[model samples]
Target: MSSEHTPPPRQQPTFLTAVAALEAVVADLDDEGFGPALGLVGGLFGSADPSEAAAAGPRLAALLPDAPPFPRAHLAMVVGACVEQGADPVACSGPVLAGLRGALTGAQRLVEGWERTGGGPLPDPEQDDPAEAHERIADPAVLDAWHAHLAVVAWWTLHLWQRAAWAVYAHPAVRTEARGSGVTAALLGLIRRYRGEQHDLKGLAHLAGMLDDEPLLVLDRPTGTGYLLRMSGLSDTFQLHTLLADVLIGGGHLPGVPQDPQVVALARTEFLDGRRVIATGAFNLVAPDGSWLWNEGTPSDIPVVDGVRTLVLDPLPYERSWSAGRFIQEIPGDLRLERVLSPAEAARLLATTAPARSAQQAFGAGQA
Candidate 1:
């Protein structure tokens, strides 16, 4: 008789299939268990597109045994090997995008459920330390693949939000509708909630130390939160408010505990409770801090309707509002930077923001 105990068949995952299987397992797990599992499993898909990751739900369910293994750098290396075998990262992105969308949606729902029932203290999965992740994930090619995959997801998240904002504001009729409605309060709520989620998701994604660019929604200046609010007050446009609300509630961006007092105060006071009106002929570049970037020779109400036309009057020479003025000056057209969101873009963006896949099946397995 053979004396040795037979080792179970090696769970040799291929690049084409690894990510999908892993994300499927992640989808099945509950909030408490998902974090740890994700650290172990997510690395398999560092360069996969969302759809492939999304599709692997069933396979992951079938493949992952209870008491799954700790993150093995070797699994990622399998992905690297496949790349060497001629797998194109860009071509593979379609499925990876689908997978990410599924993951994000599930994450968002988990947060909503927790909030609904007041789940006791939030859960944090221990991400592998950089040194550890690198040590375990020994192959440079594998690491590069992983970083590239994450970069695409992060970039898409920010780009989608920016594009969505532009789409809502570009419609004159849409802008006309919300100019004086109760939409300001609604818009405030949406912005507050989305920003809350972005705060968490962005940090989580950044923890890997792979992303090199700054977040599109910069909280420091008058542009990010301030600009959103100012426009919320000036337009009170319901379509815009609804668009933002859908992204926050439906988009799978991670949720973080909100920390900024100024942001909170402004959302509550200015957007939720402040005045809402449509400017008839006024065009002003307001800072994120709620200060006006005055055109050099014009008063705040001089009807500088054309943003680019007003650039020549920028107060950059005065250095009073250099950042805001410079931002305006950089625009190629006569339109204000804020005017970039057009209806066609909004329509295209709407399709992208649609829920890519449902979590109903994925969450069914429940903490395996």
Candidate 2:
């Protein structure tokens, strides 16, 4: 006689069960794979009619993770389902939009915490003024907070771009609608704010670098000040400079040192003739003792020197400013025809230009 065999019984899929299923898919993939998955899910759900998909929102939402390693695909699916089910995109937009907004808010809290903790690394006793200690703490803290804020804002902006691209691809009319939503203006404003924040962060980093006894709190490596300078004066060039200006002009940070005369001369020249130098590509300035300050570059070069402060500036046509006016206007000086960097310098500059983080990382994956 043959033994009787029984199959496993089917179980109903609860919201939690659905969420876990989506989360499992997310967990199995690396950072780079997340975007493709999200796109696939969006496409699948987006293809369906709004009424049918909206009915699936609850089930899709249930399948989503409540916290880290957010199931971006499931999120797209939920939105798609909502759209399919005839839920108003505006209404369906709430949860996903709220999540993004909340992420931004959380980033704000991190910044505030960093600010409350006195911003950068510790302060040096030699450089610290007893009278201004409190103000110094608060100022740098605020600036640091702003830096974090800018990063999150940039992340959100990129995210919106990706989502909008997907939506517009599905319904081309959305592209035209988006253009008129004042989004361009809002992005411009954010970019302006980012530039201002970058400037302040550079100054703070410089101040931190100057404190010889205290180690600087670098958000990244090198333990020195970094500058992000934009340059747009002469047409046909785009110059963006990131310089690491240390406390001791020539040498790294060291104790009880006389100011380098050459460095001082360089600074003065840069301050006085930088604009002309950037515009015309040539400049000669006399130091206090009458020594000449000279740094030459053609239009095609990146102005970076190994031993000296690095200045990166690009120049484009004057008319290009209409689209990137904020970026252009913020440039410290006009673009010149001189080459700033040699082949070696150019190689070094390229090495420093790292790719930006993908959308997945910006949304908190891999973050502690």
Candidate 3:
């Protein structure tokens, strides 16, 4: 589980099968318009040529307002598939674009509204038994709403669109836009909301970090908030660790935190032959005040301390999408950094904690 910037390749979304599952809905619906609705939208998302998608785009957009509550979630996937396939932007730049933006926007709106009623965990499942937990969950209508929304593809798409090849749509070239309508903002807005819910916001930093060019939506300028560094062009753990370690040592400008953060390493420690040894591995930044920053989005927290927030940006697969700018506070949760130590720190730590058994090796005077 190295937090090294090893980005898996840029795989395209599974476009064809993504919406084919929705075909099941056609059989269950009663309204006559529903069948045609499924057909029109379905064909556009099918393995049609880009020209075909372009022609069909406007028709689908016009039909949406009266389309018998067509699943916006499904529509979003279909549209994303279209983008993945290189659909002409003109078809989307019209009302079709409006529909595309609204798909993710609707999820955003839903989550934001949920935020307003209150902000805290639902009833503790551990404290309550299975039956009692169910009662507590069902008691809050908000929980019901949340579960319902999550049962669909919208939330998953929101979480995983970064893996999509067509995420290039996050930025609009002049060729892809209308006179005033926003074309690329669905992906753009997604970047901005990176600070939101844990469920909805997962994998976002990875996306922002790996982007060759993620507009730095939230972390661009200096403010009272600390900077969220871009991972653009950075390749491996070695480079990332070197840059970040230097930042910590130099008292770099992460405002609202103590100056001169300490770099702590989580070396892979093990007992060997009645002696302790540590394999060179994870590293992190720690302030005197226990403020920590490691950008590794592991399921576990830093073993060192609580409330350690990390904003690691992994370099992109290639120069392409934009990296979002962010303040440390704007990042969603307490995350970890690349589980790596800089060479200098690693050497110092090994010397201090687990020096070689022989003096010659320790002093670098051993036989070649």
Query: Using Cα atoms with residue i matched to residue i, what is each candidate's TM-score against the true structure?
Result: 0.24, 0.25, 0.33
Count of clashes in candidate 2 = 41
**What does candidate 1's lDDT look like per residue over 1-368, in tens digits?**
67988889988555345445455555675435544544555555656555554444333323323322222222223322333333443332222223323334433443443344455533322332333322332336545544433322322243332222222223323233333343323433333344224323322121111111111121111111211112222111112122222232223221222223332223223232333332111122333223333333211122222231111111112221111111111111111113223445433433322121223432352223
CA shift of 267, model 1, Å = 32
Estimate the TM-score for candidate 1. Answer: 0.24
Better of 2 and 3 by TM-score: 3
Q: Could you tell me which 10 consecutive residues in candidate 2 have the lowest summed lDDT?
A: 211-220
lDDT of 1: 0.30
Which candidate, 1 or 2, has the higher TM-score? 2
Best by lDDT: 3
The candidate scoring highest on TM-score is: 3
List all candidate RMSDs to the true structure.
21.6, 22.0, 19.7
Clashes of 1: 23
Candidate 2, residue 182: lDDT = 45
